[model samples]
Target chain A: MSNKYRDKKTGITRREILKVLGVSALSYGFLGASSKVYSKSTAHIVIVGGGIGGATAAKYLRLLNADVKITIVEPKSQYIFCPGSNEVIPGWITLEDLMVTYTTLKTHYRINVIQDKAQSINFDKKQLKLEGGDTLTYHKLIVSPGPTHHYEGIEGFNKELAEGAFPSAYSAGKQTMNLRNQILSMKKGGTIIISSPEDPYRCPPAPYERASYIATMLKDNNPTAKLLILDSKDDFIFSNNYLVYWEKHFGYGKADSMIEWVSKKKGGNVVKLDASIRAVITSNGDIHKGDVINIIPPEKAASFALQNNLAEGDWCPVDFFDFSSLLHDDVYVVGDSIEGDPMPKTGYIASNQARVVVQAINDELHGREVGSPFIINDCVAMAGQDYGMALAETFRYAGKGKKLGERYHILGAEKNKGKQIVRQQVAENWQRTFRKDVFE
Target chain B: MNKYLLRLFFILSSIGFSNSALADDDLTGGLSLKENFELAKKFPMPSPWLLSAQCSACHGTLGTAFNEIIPPLAGMDKQEFIKKMQEYKTADASNFIVMGIIAQPITDEEIEAMAGFFAKLKPEPLNQEKIPRDVVVPEWAVMNKESE
Candidate 1:
């Protein structure tokens, strides 16, 4: 009804505009702009997936422009975070602690929370089809379907195998628990085979973190239990710290070390699985038997993204300008769905990508030129509860049609115990705070 | 933009901004810190950092403050914010190599706007009803002393 919203050429008022949008304000997101806060924007933004990236996008979009219509289409009403999910495996944290709901997103941010799976996107019509054949239209679409583990990539593995006996547990839900329970009940002096996949997986250091935590969990309880980390990559993200911590605590590098890492160079790549016997066949044709096998298979963008033509190959190509799909206009590919190399696929990185995309969209609505992006990743990793580590990197846009240029730095080993404790404590705190930041 | 000139300009500009746009700040005035943050989302930001997304990555949003390694700046003293920023700009801040890299492109004008935006949010102290988070407020990070 405000005169400022008048369509001069069509003589249509802003009230008429809403009437044409026709959807219920609550059903389609309708947070009115506070005159003292922000200018009203009529742009409609839709996001798929309600994980860290999508949720953050919805929150930030509202913060930047109160009038922008935002909707999130997620299959599950509750989201389980994969970050602190590692602790769940060791019983250090529960799945409940890692769980969050979309209620706050709907109530506090006034974002439309559609409890349904986004079936397919009608790019031509700018419409997203829900499960029941219902549709929602948008001016911009954000795709943040997290990574999908390629269990099929392994000769003898599949999703069923991942969920049942040979648990991938990478996505961090029921499988994480299955894996945890399996380790807890294993016999004393048992060997647990944790086969890690190639590079470019989510949280590059996580598999190692899991190995460390698993080692700690068994240090006192099942003292002779050993953890075999068979990795596809020759080297991993935090080998320096992991080896040091492993040696100090688990007597790593000794004859009866608690944890033994088999790098790719040493025929450590697990090419096949024998779930019946709880054994893994590496590329070098070595069959290693174990009491429990955690096959964290290689990963690719979620199937939904690939099926809907949002991806080029293993991942979706994005414009550094705003994370918009390079192949599709008005469609943004964020989180693990993106092929952003040098910038690892991490929750921290995904959240940052969401921020950049929303800012770019907001700028476009204001009829301003979208500036080159400066993406930063503060990757904080911890091996044990006592030693924490951090890697800080900056990715800046090089130019049109080029991926982002990069700058990297990481915290070095400290000599003192207090410094190590501080980092470790901070890592724990960061996990809790980051969880609340997105969901709470 | 010289830092001093930028500060002077912001001071001159806020005379009008405070008198007009902020005249009806009733919602934020009597609300709880949590309620204030929910309301602050609607508050318009200044230039360069028009969106909280730019700073919120490392700084954490109002909902989640960074671990004690990086101090929360929202509702922090303006002069204190400015001093820390200046130190980073001049490469005088030790143990903040990341901040130095991030602050390189931030202009004096942008710095003023960042301070103004946080101060206006009126963030309450992080004492009672603290959100579950991993945060450490070490002395080096808390070098945000106000200008007397």
Candidate 2:
């Protein structure tokens, strides 16, 4: 094979020397002494998680380099995207519509798809141990084991409860369907309580979007029903847009409004979920009961990163230059797992971070300096099918040991009906295009 | 002594990087000595391909969009792409919404590099047989001779 994959050693090998000499002589004969030679590499890149970040890493890595072996270790064969999953709650979209398979990554890109869970990482040996007891060695590793929902963060709420009555449809899966079915079957004029968690969570605008969409669903089916959003944080992303939409449609801020939002200052931080009584206890000891409860739990770096000592507190710290893990060399952490602030946790940012990491690894394999990273997050959120909003954020690499500098601009909620409809359509188009970009 | 010399060689080699390398200085105007030194210590600017890849999230892969709410960028006229991007970057808030803000942080040279990249790409055809969706072009995104 190619000399680009020559194993690292203290001195150059004889074959490499001979290859260089042959290249130089051939260049001298063909053109001149100025021609430089580059070749394909045999380096193996192993990625954890098969969500947006992991899938994008596999796809984009193939685009940048053809010879390097890329493998993705994901337990599920198909992924249900969380971007448009909020639409599943109101029957605007189905879970099947958001599902994507790894078949394209395998057949088109020739990537190795290992349908197995990543057990742990052996940093010393640079090996990732899979749940099936297979060990895969890699020249570089990318870990994007998306965020873990700590359902226990709210006392009395556990995984079983989430699967049953109080469905936290944060991750778009069975819980998403459960939440939707709960809303559909609730008694007329029944109350639905959606407990939104604090900051630094995946898709910051999702919980609010879920609230808005569910409000629309209620307006159509259960007109007299109430939807209360108890938020842990004081305010949320796209608050202006969501608030404006809520007021116009759901009679928000009125005496007999269909929808009401309780911020943390107003005793909305849900500390406990009393499943026995179908009530949630706020931090201020206020008990609010509901017929349907959807608790979006607080989050932390996935268990894979936490157990392997890749996390510092709740997230993994990464060098902004390439998203290489600060704790381990030759290892990278992207997506919601990294301590990426000044950069919110969103799928768009995660995919962009994956692109940066692969470029860095490809550069290093080619014996070149890894490039500085610039990330852009074009966050698109919809308050309704006809109303959408967007935020543009750009992060620039500052230096070694410094967070990437950030600039963000968000448009105020659109007042023009035509613009709002167009933005909504654009958001819809983006979801379909983004899904194909990563998986297909 | 040899290690230091090798380090110096890499730093110096980075300065006059070839077109294939796509160094920041090679694409952009140029970097100051201080900026170059900072780069020498860490990493140089990312490739233009990586910068443009960010658009695919909304604009479609390589700007070959299946729908037309947002205009595709693949096979766009080089100068035309540059002009629109420059307009978006320099235009007031009322001119556009998200693209203007997104274009603000990106350097003009980066935009030029991106424009050059999209100009060369051949956009993939929409497989209408598989993806049966209607295309609706927005008013603001409509191309005109004056804008070009």
Q: Quick one: best lDDT, which candidate? A: 2
lDDT of 1 by residue, B1-148 (tens): 4443354345335432111111121111123333423433332322444333455654567422534454566777778877776666453342322454344434465577677677666443444364333233223212111210
* iRMS per model in Å: 18.9, 15.5
Candidate 1 collision pairs = A429-B134, B67-B135, B67-B136, B68-B135, B68-B136, B68-B137
- Candidate 1 chain A lDDT trough over 10 residues, lowest sum: A31-40
Please state the Cα-based DockQ of model 1 relative to the true two-chain complex. 0.06
DockQ winner among the candidates? 2
Tens-place lDDT digits, model 1, residues A24-131: 323343555321222235556889999989998898888787777777889886787788788877776667767677766665576777778988988766678889
Return the lDDT, model 2, position B126: 51
Q: Write the residue-wise lDDT of candidate 2 on A228-267 in tens digits.
A: 9999999988887888899999989999999999999999
TM-score for chain B considered on its own, for each of the candidates = 0.47, 0.54
DockQ by candidate, in order: 0.06, 0.15
Native A-B contact fraction in model 1: 0.08
RMSD of each: 13.9, 14.3
For model 2, what is the C-alpha lDDT against the true structure? Answer: 0.79
TM-score of 2: 0.83
